[model samples]
Target: MSTLIAGTPLAGRVAVVTGASSGIGEATAERFAELGAKVALLARRKDRLEDVAERITSKGGIALALPTDVTDRAAVRAAAERISVELGNVDLVFANAGVQLISEIGDLKTEDWDAQIDLNIKGVMNTIQAFVGSLEAAGTDGRPADLITTSSIAATRVLEKFQVYSGTKAYISHITRLLRTELGRKNVRVSTVEPGMVNTELPDHVTDPDASKLMADLIHQIDVLQSADVAETVSFVAALPKHVNLTELTILPTAQII
Candidate 1:
């Protein structure tokens, strides 16, 4: 009797994950590598990317660290080119590089707003733009590609002091929907992964006292989500058959309520 499981489902596939330095991005890259995919790790932090790549290579998985700032279009394109040369055509891409700047409506912090918009919105665009051509080409060659974006549950649900961050995520959420419509015919799958209350350094970047307090309260109230949980979801989605496309996935802690 043969088992109905295939090991290394992503064997021969190349995956690119932005924001690979830590948290969800790091976990996704490691998960992809574990599943036998050659992973390209992209982030602004060279040391962190190198560390993640070292762990992957040490575990007998292929990984390449390409330090990049997703907000820069040229840097993202160059990183994509390097991935093409080193890992072959990318079969999967996780546009997960993002930052959260939480402030109340009256705070009037234009810099925080700009930071969130640039990294969360433009960064996502740069990643998608840099890889869409390759993904489409891969499809034409009979290999369907997957594009997954890391959104936030805040996009759909209201969260205090998350106004700008939520708006940016919502933008990407709709953009992902549009991409799915545009790329479906070409056999490229586009999806968004929205998570809630993940215990990551994301909240640490918040400067608003009220927002920080809210984050702390949320963490104390519910079972916090983990980077591994999101990573598992990403791997599961990526491992599915090419014909299956999970358009949007919202992952939340069981104890959390909208």
Candidate 2:
């Protein structure tokens, strides 16, 4: 079986990335392709996924764009099944679909809370449910399989006005750790990548005017980390030796804390 090394550790592997239309998810998909993995990009926007797939194909990488919404269990399952049929097997799964909404507990809208929970929490569960079997099969065939989920520093640090968003991230961190315990014996690695203040469309999902202003201010005050930084970290974790599992990684700019 081939292994991902520093240069191109993902060579000959198959990776399925959720929320691949933009931001960290898209960046991670591109990086996986660059490392020689056959990548399947799954997202709701067919046009955006196709564009990314075209770019990968143009660069001599193998890619398939599957229009999907991670929040939909049936759709996510179908996408995984399609990848298994077409790409052979999934060696890695990135459960990266997430949203950010900032609202004070007193002022929080129920709909905003539900949206965040559905995407950030339920979506990760859906991705894992859809791909764990394929990932296990990949390992049985002597291929190392990995499950990487995107969490956030919010999971650890709770600030004012981010109650629901922080809670959702905390759930991700908890569930990934539990999965690591359960899957370790199966030789299927599980890892969570926690990033701080990344520059992405995550903040754009915020609808509250006051909350958005506060978040924008905080983002501008700090040198917000880029999606590429987190994507590189994802690659590094996925490239580890079969026996080596990086259970958790938290990355933040040197100048930022909490």
169, model 2: CA deviation in Å? 0.8
lDDT of every predicted structure (CA atoms): 0.90, 0.87
What tens-digit string does per-residue lDDT give for candidate 1 at 1-258?
A: 122224788888999999999999998898889888999999999999999999999999999999999999999999999999989999899999999988778979999999999999999889988998989988778785899999999898877778999999999899988988889889998999999889889999998898898778989988888898898888888888888999899998888776
Q: Which ranges of candidate 1 are over 4 A from the true structure?
A: 1-6
Weakest lDDT window of 10 consecutive positions for candidate 1? 1-10
Question: Who wins the TM-score comparison?
Answer: 1
Candidate 1, residue 1: lDDT: 16
**TM-score between candidate 1 and the true structure:** 0.95
User: Per-prediction TM-score, please?
Assistant: 0.95, 0.94
- lDDT score of model 2? 0.87
Which segments of model 2 are wrong by more than 4 Å?
1-6
How many steric clashes does model 2 contain? 2
